[model samples]
Target: MNAPFPIRKECPPGACVCNRQALLSDPQADIRILKLTREEESRLLARLETLSSLADLKKMESRLHEQLGIVLTITPSIHEVRTLRGISIQLQEQPGLCRKTKQAIPAAIRRSLEKSPDIAYAILDAHGLWDGT
Candidate 1:
């Protein structure tokens, strides 16, 4: 039985399992790169530019620095705060489901970034927030 997906093998002791196809497809996956439209890229860039004050930029940088990873930058439905909060609580309880990596942070905090922060930040992005390069 060649399991292509990364499994902890100790989930809840009897957790219902699904997504065999996904595991078979992306077993041992490390990175998840996504392509974006020019407009999307520009919007993300514009948000970065809005970090005018050093304090704001520092906050952004700190958020990014503290990410568990698992990037989800292109999520369009992230503007929903309440939904994100629920997800956050779930994630906090299920820390074993996935490792916190640079990739996961963007996806997990999508709503928070879109609504409260209005700026996309990632711990893997770099040291500066408005590092417009």
Candidate 2:
């Protein structure tokens, strides 16, 4: 008598019993990079130049969502660290959303940096630079 070999079964992600939602919900699991064109970068800088208050930031967030489909949460922070001394920006999790960094800078930071073009210029390349750069 010949014995049959054990059968191997592979489960698809959708059919798997593992907690997929938990894995998918992890903010750090699916990091994405955002690339902006010259025109877009210029538009963003122009917006930043006029950012005067949280209300303006809200409008900017709405505009970004409509134009770029990105979710952003900008808030002022009082951290002792130089990098975090001004403000922080966070990209909220949403389907079809991919970003280079997880953080962002708030309007207050932009207002404060109005007098320091050098610092703003250094951080202008990418919004993520406000995190720790």
Highest TM-score: give the candidate number.
2
Show the lowest summed lDDT stretch of 10 residues, model 1.
88-97
lDDT of 2 by residue, 1-133 (tens): 1113321122355543433344345665422212233345455756665665545556777876775456776544444324434545666664323222222234434554555545444443334445665
Poorest 10 consecutive residues by lDDT, candidate 2: 1-10
**Segments in model 2 whose C-alpha atoms lie over 4 Å from true places:** 1-36, 76-86, 92-133
Model 1 stretches astray by more than 4 angstroms: 1-26, 30-38, 63-133
lDDT of 1: 0.36
TM-score of each: 0.24, 0.39
Candidate 1 lDDT over 1-133, as tens digits, reads 3433333332232443323234436656422211222343345445544554435645655543353222222322323434433223122222222332223334434534445443333322333433676
Instruction: Report the Cα lDDT for residue 22, model 2.
Output: 42
Over all chains combined, what TM-score does candidate 2 have?
0.39
* Residue 65 lDDT, candidate 1, scale 0-100: 30
